[model samples]
Target chain A: MVEIQNTPPHADAEFHHHHAHATTSRHEHGHHLLQVSHLSVGFRMYDIDAPFLSAEQRTVNVIDDLSISVHEGEIVAVVGASGSGKTLLADCIMGLFEPNAEVRGEIWFDGEPMDAMDLAAARGHGISLVPQGVSHLNPLMRVGRQVDGFGYSRAEQTERTARRDKLFSRYGLAPEVAQLYPHELSGGMARRVLLCTALMDDPKLIIADEPTPGLDLDLAVAALDDFRSFADEGGGVLLITHDIELALRVADRVAVFKDGTVVEETAVANFASPDLLEHPFSRALWHALPEHGFSANDQDHPIPIQSTAFEQGGSSDGGDATC
Target chain B: MLEALSITFGYAKGDKPLYEDYSLEVAPGERVALVAPSGRGKTTLCRLLAGYERPWSGEVLCDGSPLPSSGTCPVQLIGQHPELAVDPRLRMEKTLAEAGDVSDELLAALGIRQEWMRRYPHELSGGELQRFCIARAVTCRPHYLIADEVSTMLDALTQAQIWHFLLNWQAESGAGLVLVSHSPALVERVATRKVLIG
Candidate 1:
């Protein structure tokens, strides 16, 4: 059984002040770019037997008591196995959860509680997403128009086109690619197009989900460098990926996700040694790294309910336990 | 042996050939990894090897003979996307049956549960579905198998598990294997020989 614990209010306040002060001076009171507190997501599914007759309902809790924060000028990479609720967390944050999903949590963006309208407006403006699937691109539209967000004004279209071309070149895509449809682009080109779409809007927070899957080594590194530079320019990034080594290169902090919730969030430096990471799952991931000889043998190991790291004040501000 | 002799391939009629005068050979009991950046026609090359697509020039040969045009291909190809490869209308068991007789031992080794056979392709996760696809390919007892980034989307543990099973199968059968992947580390660990392509 998993025990749920609420994060202390002071921890949230501390995270807010720490990150807000690090990037801008406009907000006098503590305000985090993104803060999620006591977030829990559960999907209600019908039982295998007697779907309509029985009143029995099964709730599979995908995320439980998870709290994470992203401050200005920080890249927090969430590393986890596939099917470990990583994508669900992103969907919940974007308010794009399925109709059957019951979410109970406090999600604050720019010091304001995010409702449905706020989340819808914040999407692609205040917060941009680099989705994992390249299929997100519209097959019917030209790559340039898709990246430009289909703007109408003549001057705005011209400016957006210039920006799109520059980004395409930076991503190693040819200028001629602008006129092509999504189906015409290669897998790598399509992925770069998605990245260009996310970067098209100068959002405060960027949520990149497995953005480097199909890319080669050099291009993957270049993409990570882009995110690093974006964070350096006072933008927050939530880099969700399966590639721990890639994430470690550009992330300031690393959050290890297990069965559902984040088991440990530590400074990137702590990843130098498995001993520095408090959670077993985090250590497993570290051991599974290619440089570490990929010695992780725990195929059926169950994820622990609570980690010593979390219990020992492993909140956003208190993440420097070993570092 | 599986051999591609001076093959030329391009998606379109007049487009610059993606592969111009490309030649490759794989002997029995050999594991050859094809390393290249994405969209460099790795999948296309695999399709050509498995006779899913014909080459514009030259020929693909198995054991010094051209690949049979019909019935029971000796070369099997497992694509990157398991969803696209499978039929959504059929159950998992039916899909596996199409490949020929599948041993329970093979299914067990690949971590394919018995209950999963009852479910449709859409009901399973990517990793789970991939296991079935791999099982289907190996169960056919092909002389050569081409796996195109088979476990790229899976978790580390699952990836390791699948590789372990495949390596074991290769050892037992002495079948030639062609692994197409972008992962340098995985290629270094698994491949006995490497083929670098742009």
Candidate 2:
């Protein structure tokens, strides 16, 4: 995996818009991997009234002047309330936005201007994205083949196979699952497969959009840990999530987006401070967190060996409170 | 009352059985929480209770009678992912309408607005969509509701509001609530009794 060293050129520094109010600017190594400047995406509507033509371009801006940077080897989590442009930002990053939607501003990778419509080009230059849904994989394709895409050389094959196993273990999945199709896998398994494919290319930056949106705590933590490991290993991670618990727990730095603007950005070291909860919106979000009876330590506690489905009466062991 | 007796089921080809033999009973107006590690059949049990799937063995009893497969059962199951619950092609209004008439009370209780009804699934946020899914689940007026992480995506305030609405609905309707969540605090707040699954 280390043989594919992505020494991509640094994008122009002018594209990064540093917020005047940003308190901490301690970025990880590697120059700005991606820089978005004065970017805004919107669409036109045919139903709008026009002077002559029946069709009109009604601009519904999904993301406005959304400038965020992911340096090499850093986990930057984009946290926001749902419908707050988090996914749209991710879509723009992945070049998956609709053609009808007019996208302004520039997305640069490795000091190169990224063509917004070309996912393959974006993917080739050390960039891969795992979508919100695991449906990114071809339903008919086996997980192994889905992850082990064709490349040019013998080394590429070896790398792909090695990376596949690494991902399977990193994501807490068994190697045998490589033979299963997307539909054959469980929700969690499907997600791991999507993540494996994203990591298979060893991209300089990996973007995960709500990677654990609806998963249980145990699974959510495990998924985040996998992403964190990637970041720890000199790779960049852009996490798009609405879950503050995850942002607080896993993100090294956080950017809060509201109505297409970056409302707040704080280092996770200071996440528990009153300043983090002081923002009205963040406060509203904080209060909504479940008072799950267990504390953070409890949340991370490893599952005991006794925890298995078979132990409980197949279907009839009436619900029991006893552990 | 909702009761399951020695239910056993697994995917047709899958060698691992999700439920070997599991039984659970929830009395009227009881709020039970089912907690377990991931992939431990918490969802399968909810499906059986909700009548979305049948148990390979044993029978599901609703109100002391065997649950009928053809019609809407007395139980509703809300999966962890709200996006999966709502059809992508349908608007929120139509999604709610599928349950029956959309009442203002239900809309307000869910913090959803009349304007939202016109929007598509892609337009709504994760939190809003989840609430809408919950409202739709209750549209048939099921006697028992199996909420599988309905509030998983929601922020704190919205979760509290939803919990309040659910508690009030349970009290007023005298319906049982079977909640599945990994959040211990959530279980504490809404679950009268907590059942831990492996």
lDDT by residue (A67-136, candidate 1, tens digit) is 7777667788887766566777787778776777788888888778887678878888889998765567
Q: Scoring model 1 with DockQ, what do you get?
A: 0.19
Tens-place lDDT digits, model 2, residues A1-323: 01122334323221133421122222333345666667787664453234657665455555677777766666788876555566667767877666567888877765567776554577645888877665667888887987888754888888778878988997888999998887888877777788788877778789887777556666788778878778777777888776677677777777776656666655665455435443554444444566531211111112110111111111111111000
lDDT of 2 by residue, B70-136 (tens): 7776788877767778898998889888888868878776667665676766655656677788788
Top-TM-score candidate index = 1
Q: List model 1 lDDT by residue over B1-198, tens digit each.
A: 999999999999988999989999999999999987766888899999999999999999998988899888899998877878899899899999998889988887786777668777655656667888999999888999999988776655566667777888999999999998767787888899999887
The models' CA-based lDDT, in order, is: 0.74, 0.68
Overlapping backbone residue pairs in candidate 1 total 0
TM-scores of all candidate predictions against the true structure: 0.82, 0.78
| Stretch of 10 with least lDDT, candidate 1 chain A | A314-323
DockQ (Cα-based) per candidate?
Answer: 0.19, 0.28
lDDT of 1 at A82: 60
The per-prediction tally of clashing pairs is 0, 24
Instruction: Show pairs that collide, candidate 1.
Output: none
